[model samples]
Target chain A: MIVIENVSLSHRDTPILRDIDLSLPRGGITALVGPNGAGKSSLFSLIARLQPLQKGRITVDDMPVDTTPSRTLAQRLAILRQDGAVANRLTVREIVGFGRFPHHRGRPAAEDLALVDAALSEFDLHSLADRFIDTLSGGQRQRAIVAMTFCQGTDYLLLDEPLNNLDMFHARQLMRCLRTIADERQRTAIIVLHDINQAASYADRIVALRDGRVIADGTPDDVLTEDHLESIFGYRMKVEHMNGKPFVLHHL
Target chain B: MPDRRMIVLAAIALIAVLLFLTVGLRGNVQFVLQLRALKLLALLQVAISIAVSTVLFQTVTANRILTPSIMGLDALYLFGQTALIFALGGFGYASLDAGTKFGAEVLLMIALAGALLWPLIRTRMDMNLMLLMGVTLGLLFRSLSQLLSRLLDPNAFAIVQTASFANFNMLRADLTILGTIITLAAVVVSWRARHVLDIVGLGREAAIGLGVSWIRTAAGLLLLVAILVAVSTALVGPVVFFGLLVAALAERVMRTQRHALLLPAAALIAIIILVGGQTLLQHGLGGASTLGVVIEFVGGLVFLALLFHESRK
Candidate 1:
């Protein structure tokens, strides 16, 4: 389980995340849903150790995020931030191969190569393996980066807005892939998403944030209520039950 | 792959060896050959140090256009030398042991690099801020050096001028040995940190995500790069943009992000440029033009081309 206790983060004297306490169990998709300036990315950054902890304590699988060695923490949790820009001119395979760096360092054994190859095939990137990352399309590059993160084989995967720049078809496909990875691999995925329907359809649990605080947290069915949606999003949205799942009608 | 690198390396080696033999032998004088060899060694040292250091610096910065000199290392070196000369007149400066002077210069350079770059690495300052600070510090040092030189006697000022210009022929043998040691140490340090460098080139956040201690790695690499620049500058003055040229050329040729390949490739390219250029200057150009002037001219053109290419792309 991942535990965040009394987490409060401020940037340059402006509060970004306030006194947040939450526990996330292993083995399912938890979609972090919020509007702009909701501290979703900031929370992810703190959790992933991209930024130092400020007035908070977080533990992943009983290991303190701040005190644990980075290599050890890396082996347990992997994060994919939105718009991950790698400036180097690396090929797809090479970039994906970096996922295994913690395990093998620079000297990659055959097992490492096998894992990298598997990730490439899983993401449908085998054909583009030799192509440089800058040459890949937006959706393809997103998939490639996701594949690299997944290849890390961490139990808890934190994806901050994985659906950015993705079209409807690719976005859905990525969500389905994540769902399969969570279900089949029994890994926990905390995905920060903007599209409400995607969260409703794919995430087993939906955690809603507003003004740097968690306003609602429960099963998707419970969190998708019109009242909760209105309070969280500050807009009236019709919630329809279709195929035993709440479908939010907010496209208008 | 090793075979291919070997083949390219062997070709360059063959050319260097041939140049080494012919340049000294063609003169047909025993003393002249020895002098030519010393000059060649000095040129080779400067080239290798700048090339290797620049590539390492760019890798840490994740910038193709930056070199170690961009951080004002050359200006610091000049300032240190001018300060020494100013405090101790020309007679005293000339009387001082060459080894002591070399050690003092290197020590001062390292201290300056640490003072200027350590904070950036430790605090994770923005790249723009680091560059701005480096440029500003460099300008300050240059102005200080000029001011000091202005107060010196004309004879002392002339000595300082000779010391500041990039000249291989005037290189002290002890300085060459000291430079070689520092350059090797920098190479080893960089080699040990090669894996981290590969991750660092992925930009800041990805490196952190990959569990790299960005601060430590950046600090270590920056220091190493500073030492390298110091060695080159102390030995033959500053060759601005030389590292950028070699690193850019290496990237284009090797087409690899792996520093294991990139570092050696850049080093080899530096050797080729230095040795080849020196050979040509001595034989083809008959030493009429200075190697530093030619290299800076080419390096400047390459720098502009890179900026244009990046902007266009």
Candidate 2:
């Protein structure tokens, strides 16, 4: 479980996130949906300790985010941001192997190597495993990075805008991968997503934010409505149901 | 393939060592050999120091184009010498023990490096901003050094000239020993932390997410860079772009991001450049110019080529 209490972040006198009180239970996918500048990334940054908290307490499971040693926090949680520039001249397999750093420090055991192999297969990257990251396409590189985060084997995973630059086919493939992993591995994942339909389809719960504040939070059926989304996004969108799931159509 | 490259580099470095030691010998065979050996040791130490320092600095900054010397370190070294000369005069400064002076310069460089670089790296500011600040500070230090140097007498000025420029002929045995010990220690630390450095090259966010304490690792590596740069500068006065030349060559030739291979490869390349270039300058050029001139010429060209290549990309 992750609990965020009285969290407020301000930069240069401009509040980025204000009084963001929320709790996320363990073992499910939570899609964080918000319009641009809605503090979605900021919230992920806070949870991952990428940015220091100014006014509040956050705890993952029982460990306080602020007080826990970085290694301890890393072993329990992993974060992949929107625009991460990887080291050049490294192959996909090598990059994924870095996720096991917290566990092995500098020396990798046999088990660590096995896990890296598993992550590569899990992401369907066997053919591209030996390819250099810089040589891979945007979608392929995204999958490799996601595979790295998953290889960390943390119970809690936070990904910010992981779908950026991906084509439709790759995006669907990635979302399906995340959904299956969260369910089968019994891991909790908080993903910041821009495509409402993707979130609506794969997210067990959807949390909506607008202007650094949470406007709505619940199951997709309860929160992803035309009225709620219009208020949150400052525009109207069509919400349709299919197979007991709500889908948002913002493009039309 | 990397192992093959390493072997080739090692062979080249060894051949250069042999040429440096025995290519030409005149009267007083023992004395000449001893002198050449001292110079060789000094060159090797400087090579190791600059190569390792530059590679590590690039890793932390995540910019292959930058070297530790860009952060006003060499300028500060020049400033230290000029300040000492101005306060104590030529004779007084020259009369001071060399060991004590070397110790003071190393300490001061470390202090200056920490003051100039720590906060920027710790706060994780824009790398371009950090680079700009470094360049500006370098200019300021150079200006200050020039101001003090102009006030000195001719004899003092000559002394400063010898210390200000890279001179392989002025190598000292005691200082070479000290530098060797310090450089060896840095090499060990870097080797031990090769895996950590690999992650560090991934940039700060990912490194932190991987649980490698980003701030601490960067700070430690920067400190190591300071030590390595200080030792090299103290031995061979500010070979400004040599680090860039060797580090770039190592990265280009090895084509590997792993520091364990990269560090040694860079070191070997540096040895080849310094010792081989020194041999050519002595034998081919007949000591018409210092090795520093040749290095600066070649290294400056490499730097420009790299800039051009990066721009095209």
**iRMS of each prediction:** 1.2, 0.8
Clashing residue pairs, candidate 2? Answer: none
Q: Whose DockQ is greatest here? A: 2
For residues B106-215, write the lDDT of model 2, one tens digit per residue: 88888887886667666756656766777898899999989988888888889988888888776668888988899899889988999899999999899889987766
* Pairs clashing within candidate 1: none
**Model 1 TM-score on chain A:** 0.97
- Per-residue CA lDDT of candidate 1, range A194-228, in tens? 99899999999999999899999999999999999
Q: Note the DockQ of each predicted structure.
A: 0.71, 0.85
- lDDT of all the models against the reference? 0.83, 0.88
Instruction: For candidate 2, write residues A1-58 as lDDT tens digits.
Output: 9999999998899998989999999988999998999999999998998877789999
| Least well predicted 10-residue stretch by lDDT in candidate 1 chain B | B20-29
